[model samples]
Target: MPLVNIDIIEGVFSAEQKQIMIKKVTDTMVSIEGENLRGVTWVKINEVKQGDWGIGGQTLTANDVKAMAQG
Candidate 1:
């Protein structure tokens, strides 16, 4: 069994986006681990509250990420 944990700031992704991410992650794992492990593969998506996550010593939020992406 393979357990994958992904953490991101809350509100950065929509429900559909999250689903796509999950699917892609599972597919990637299946590709590497083979079909048998698909049944036991686990993917966890953790969303941290805005301002609660920090990077480079600065607290970041969803909007900050969006702005960074656009620039």
Candidate 2:
């Protein structure tokens, strides 16, 4: 049985992106494990508080990461 847990900051991905992610993850597991595909499950999607997630001592939201990457 292959189980996947994906965690991310809130408001980052749209519905279509999430669906594609699920499909890709499941397909990869199926390809690698064959019959084990039946046992594969996407556990949960968690939205963490911005203040709870940090890098270099500063809390970061999803937008912050995007902004940083653009610069």
Candidate 3:
């Protein structure tokens, strides 16, 4: 069985977007491993606290990551 885990800070994602992400990730795993779809297990989404995460010695909020990526 293939196990998948996705971790992200709390935020709003449309249901359709979540489903699509799951589908694409699972499908990619299936193609790579040649495993049955039914054998795959997707773990629940994990939300990390902003204060608990850091980048470059500074606590990184969700907005910080976005802003840095855009620059």
Candidate 4:
């Protein structure tokens, strides 16, 4: 079995976006590994609290990511 784990800041993406991510990631994995593995491939999206993720010694929040996207 293959597992694809995705971590993102909480509230950064909507439920629909998360579903799309899971589907697309699974499809990509199956395309590379083979159809037989499609059923066994797992894509998990884990969400961390907005202030729990850190980078460069600073805690990151969903707003930080959204701001980065805008610029």
Task: Point to the candidate with the largest lDDT.
Answer: 1
The residue pairs in collision within model 2 are: none
Determine which window of 10 residues in candidate 3 has minimal summed lDDT.
36-45
Query: Which residue pairs of candidate 4 clash?
Result: none
What are the C-alpha RMSDs, in order, of all predicted structures? 0.7, 2.2, 2.5, 0.7
Residue-level lDDT tens digits of model 3 in 1-71: 76787776544345676677778887788888776664655635566887677767888777776676689
Alpha-carbon RMSD, candidate 1: 0.7
- Please, what are the lDDT tens digits per residue for candidate 4 over residues 1-71? 99999999998999999999999999999999999999999999999998899999999999999999899
Candidate 4: C-alpha lDDT = 0.95
Candidate 2 Cα misplacement greater than 4 A, ranges: 35-39, 69-71
Q: Global CA lDDT of candidate 2, please?
A: 0.74
lDDT of 1 at 19: 94
Between candidates 1 and 2, the one scoring higher on TM-score is: 1
> TM-scores, in order shown?
0.95, 0.74, 0.68, 0.94
What TM-score does candidate 2 reach? 0.74
- TM-score of decoy 1: 0.95
Off by over 4 Å in 1: none
lDDT of 1 by residue, 1-71 (tens): 99999999999999999999999999999999999999999999999999999998999999999899899
